[model samples]
Target: MFGLTFEKLLLIGVIAAFLIGPDKLPHYAQQLGKLVRNMRDYANGAKDRVRDEMGPEFDDVDWQKLDPRQYDPRRIIRDALTDEPEAAPAAPSPNPNSAYLQHRAKQQALATGELPPFDNEAT
Candidate 1:
């Protein structure tokens, strides 16, 4: 079940048969079967306990909606990138001390063929 196909399981069983030998393979196989059964029972018991604790609401849960497999990182990113952003609030009066205004001023100076203001302290 953990990525082991039927063919792989067969190969493993064959190897186990050779390694364990015909004398004691049956005992080990029986133990493995018991282990698998117990694990399955444990999982089912846990599920039942959760259902009991959750009451009737557990049956109404939309499990498919919560499934991790349904999420695609690429699709999520694409949707986010393609979606139009919400309109920004109306601009307030520009503050001279703001970095955005400073950058804008620099851009305007460059566009008008003037040297942008520079701070010697920043260098």
Candidate 2:
């Protein structure tokens, strides 16, 4: 359950058997099983308690939406790579005297070390 594959778990069992020895192995195994069971029971009991305290409205919550794993990089890249129609580009303004052009001019002047005439009206 903790990302352990069958081979890794078998290797761990062999090591444990060797370290613990055959005589006390069953006792230790039983204890380990009991510990796992108790942990699962405690988790389930806590979940039940939280659900009881929160009431029926909690059942309607979109749990997947709240999960942080949904924002994983793999999912984000997959979504971006899908063949969705691109969003339409914004229409260009016909007016040449737009504030953006003025801003660009100001930026060009600043790049050339010539400050654009500052308007006192801006104050």
Candidate 3:
């Protein structure tokens, strides 16, 4: 189909006839016809094979279901993601107090490093 037109082909044929003369045009045409026939047969056979193997299910299936160009892969993945819950934003650290509490902790540990009587040792 290659955008071939009757006028363009006729032009090509006129040139071929002049260049190759009346001796080989018929032979080339026959060969071209055979090539086209073989291509059509191959395509038909492939289609028949798929239809036979897939059976009624294939026939009944919506054609759009098989069209890769029209499929939305994201829809399936998005559905799967939506099925899971967002982890409750990590429970904020048990101790929300920062700088002051952290410093007090360090001081407590240091003052009681090797002693048991240290709950009131810092004072």
lDDT of each: 0.74, 0.73, 0.69
Question: How many residue pairs in model 3 have overlapping backbones?
Answer: 0
Writing each residue's lDDT as its tens digit, candidate 1 over 37-116 gives 99999999999999999999999999999999988654454345444433332563355334344344645334666677
The better-scoring model by TM-score among 1 and 3 is 1
Report the Cα lDDT for residue 78, model 2.
Answer: 35
What is the Cα-based lDDT of residue 105 in candidate 1? 60
Question: Which regions of candidate 2 deviate over 4 angstroms?
Answer: 72-123
Better of 1 and 2 by lDDT: 1
Candidate No. with top TM-score: 1
User: For all the candidates, what are their Cα RMSDs to the real structure?
Assistant: 12.1, 11.1, 17.7
Taking the tens digit of each residue's C-alpha lDDT, what string does model 2 give over 58-110? 79888989898767553354345544523432664466344345445545335
For model 2, the run of ten residues with the poorest summed lDDT: 80-89
